[model samples]
Target: MEDKANKAWTDLIQEYQIDNAIKQHGEFIIQAKDIKKYREPRLMAKWDSSESLPTILKKSDINILPVSRSAYVLSNFKLYQPFPENDINTVKYVPPLPLESIDFNNLSTESNAINAMLITGILDDFLGTNNTVETFNGRMGTNDFSFTVNLTNGGKRQVDVQSAQLEIDGGFENDDSIIIMEAKNVPHPDFHIRQLYFPYRLWCERVRKPIRLVFSQYIDSIYHLYEYEFAKEDDYSSIHLIQQRNYSFQSSAISWDDIQRIIDSNSPEIDDNYDDTSIPFIQADLFTRLISLIEQLDKVPNMTSAEIASSMEFDIRQASYYSSAGEYLGVIERPLRGHSQLSLTGIKLMRLKLRERRLELIKLIVRHNIFHDLLSQIIDTGEFPSREAIIDRMRRYNVCKDATTLYRRASSVSGWLRWIVTLPDTTEEFE
Candidate 1:
């Protein structure tokens, strides 16, 4: 799909002399009809992030934005903004209301997660507001508006819009302001500003109250909310983060004793002759990202490798690494036909509550000899084992023979161990 889009755009650009036009005017407005000559404008223009841009546009550092219902503007401008690093250490656990109807364990969509957050009062707590009501949402046509965006060349371009379509995942209003939220279920490093900017500009014209733009992402059972503001309302590039918060309905507090208990418990021993060579050694580092990948697999069964890479915003090779890591843990089945699906074990693991799910994950990781031994050493010494020590263990177990591979895999081992040790203790109360 990406290649096809790239080819279409490349053809369109050459045929229409868009490059020359942008060179002269600093921007080029291409109508839907002109784009439709090669490909559907909707498919060609729907780049949600900078990484998703077609080769020509990305190489030229050009961004595309809808200037009107029938036209799009292309320029060498900064259109995508990176999300701030999420500090899960500061996550606040907001208990679910007694009458909550949403089954958070099976959340499959952004709407489901957002609704759960609202019902549990996570949104209200994060926003410091009460009686927040969902007022306007879904696709709406924008009224005529204009904004200025900074170009990569340190120049500015004026953008005008008339009846261009914009959608709000959720629009919540309190007495003081209207919150325009753009929700995403899959994690991405950054997002296109148009998702929030268009709705914000439209709402500002419609409402007398202040318009607050928020980006909501639900990943691995955590709802990350980021509130952003345009310092200059009419400047598209003026968007900046005001504050951000992480929230969860489940308890994120897991004590060291809890990990210790898992280490000491008597469980079925791993097969002694299990072939380590059958699967790739773990190179994917972030444990939470692994869990997030599993969650995505649970939601959409039998996803192709390409779909996984596109949906997770990972490269094809990284997708393979995570898929192999999942298979190594005996929770994912990648068939010869190239479709990846959760194994029976993975499906059952997903059904467990947050605490049990996490514990089950820990058990799965430690079931392997290397992680088990490393975790035991950590418990005994109260310190992480050295890289050399971990690499030696990998060598001894015949995990990998290549020195570079061993070092990379050792780093992954250290990362997972750190994640286990840093779990917040449940006994501590958060005020």
Candidate 2:
């Protein structure tokens, strides 16, 4: 049973893998909203009321300060500590990538994996920071109340889950305490653990402070993030699921069954290199840039690196994907700063723009016309239309031609069709 569960999440992760061809043929959907905001009211109410117990314990236990507010112990756990010199354990499988790398064109599993890895890296950075700052506001209804106030048996107090949303769990990880995250490509019933517990323990071993667990998932270019906080333990062993919010996908409740289904399906790609312990997902930026180059191409006029960059927002690595689309991936040069108004004939510019739009159009057309219909029918129960049969109807019908390609060298008619569609008369309605 345990084996089945673990395999389930792993499988779900793979299906969500951006590298998988399924994505190329997929129609991307916006990720879901925050989970905490959508959890059942009764469940949330219970969680909210649960916090009051801490206050109750503090008042009655009188010794709560000894356990929770020990300045001496906590101060010794200084936040201002420096990062220990790098060790083999901290070795970079992939070194830190610049945020600037985010400026790119299309998407691919490999690039998205890199991007996802970087986002996870930021969490590590926060955990490595030692200095902690307290940022809370306090107000006294009246200092006179201190004269006769009861914190124990009776007092004017109310606790609710209202603080959930505004609550930023785990301060920027004071000391070596990290919020360990296991990222996957799909939903896994057992994924809740791999993406949650294991990473928590791994990081917990690295530092004196407790490690929190997080699960990040990517489905069709969308990222879904979930977090878990442990409960109080006697031997520092038990895990208490304190707070969980599904912020990466849709506004819906996922049962234990939902997890099973996703994992049972295809899963995300995990690096076996790290003893199957720590695996990073594909990055979004690098992949997107790759896609962009494929989307826009030109035959007559060789496009300069700057022209490609303009379409890709200046990511040099991604710009290469453009020139090498379908054949090889290369990095020629990042788009130059200013070339939007470069000297070029109106026809030349039109051709370049069409080349670009065509790539996107091809992918979009395939997704709406093909994958969505097929995947939806198999995964969920929905008979849909295959737009491929009627691609002519929605787009420019009059410009029909023999063939069209995502690349620039497809044919002359392709460019003419694109140009004619965007032009006035004979073009759709407004013409």
Candidate 3:
């Protein structure tokens, strides 16, 4: 049974290898071994919530400070420098993109989406460096190498990863360096360093130019690009974030007045179709996250909670929250007694025009009682409501919580409403 379970887990990981570069890069993290051996939730005991125990041990059992020892003790550990502070004064100009003429309805594949960005000059705008394509979908290295993987949990083993199967979606040559890219459709908190490391290594051997590793995500009509480099070249685990920024091919500006109109209407006639009980009203970017969930469902319909969590590299609890949000929007369903799947609404959502989809979401929010009532009040007031005012509104609706929790929930409500009101239009301008 254990053997079967391990195989199942490995298979699940393989299924989620959307691109060859990411897949090959992940091998160093898990080392082609059972995932159970590398679970590192235990390292979070010192700073994680006091409400629950970590997966590997009790808080009292661990003696070392996690800030210093996390990488030494946990497999797939990520070490990041201080986050880059947002500087509003330094905003760069985002020129118009070539995506204006492309039809999003037919842009289903990752390669196609990537090509659109390239042709549209998004790469140059976001990275602040113009580049020409050097190679696309190419491989290097011979298939005859085995290395010992030093496990974070104090173990070492040999594994054969034949020739490093180095693949990159797009390689760009700028003025002084080559940028090796690994692209994904979803934005993740962190990525396997191997994705950038192996390619950087292979190319360094073939060319004298400096190599820069880039991870790109195209989501919700915006492009998020991150650049990374290994602190110690040839060290698969030395990846660190150099810089990260978000850019939109078109402006995503939305105004408070625009949101007021939606709040004052009955376009979304309330119905008994939504289930808000299991959904959190306080999550960050809940609407966009829900849309991302729908995209995953569109790719692989009828995935269980565990499968969805694994595929998206989210914790099971987080996966549940996203799935529940989809259910609340009436975009997902469970035709089988125990299995969850996309409903007719979700399918139609995938097929609709992008503008139509955003409108549908606005209508859905206006149709929900809590969102509708609260937003109506906020809209009626000429200014942004205070946190106290928001919490008071929540209290009136029986969404009561403790002081801290209420404050956080209120912030979420304000942010989400702002996001809804400011939903970007599909209209575009060509350079």
Candidate with best TM-score = 1
lDDT tens digits by residue: candidate 2, 264-359: 443323211212222111112223333334434421224555555444333333344334332212222224432112123222322333233333
Residue 53 in candidate 3, Cα distance off native in Å: 15
Note the residue pairs that clash in candidate 3.
254-422
lDDT of 2: 0.28
Cα lDDT tens digits, model 1, 185-272, are 7767789999999999888888899888889988777778999999998999999999997877777667678888888883535432
| Model 1: CA > 4 A from native | 17-21, 153-155, 260-276, 282-289, 306-321, 366-422, 425-431
Q: Model 2 — which ten-residue stretch has the worst lDDT?
A: 70-79
Once fitted onto the true fold, the runs of candidate 3 whose alpha carbons sit more than 4 angstroms away are 1-103, 125-131, 134-167, 174-176, 192-194, 228-255, 267-285, 299-301, 373-392, 400-415, 421-430
Residue 384 in candidate 3, Cα distance off native in Å: 6.0
lDDT of 1: 0.81
Predicted candidate 3 versus true structure: per-residue lDDT over 157-189, tens digit per residue = 344434544457788887877888877665453
lDDT of each: 0.81, 0.28, 0.55
Q: Give, for candidate 1, the lowest lDDT window spanning 10 residues.
A: 266-275
Give candidate 2 regions above 4 Å deviation: 1-177, 185-195, 202-206, 232-431
- Summing lDDT over every window of 10 consecutive residues in candidate 3, give the lowest-scoring window: 63-72
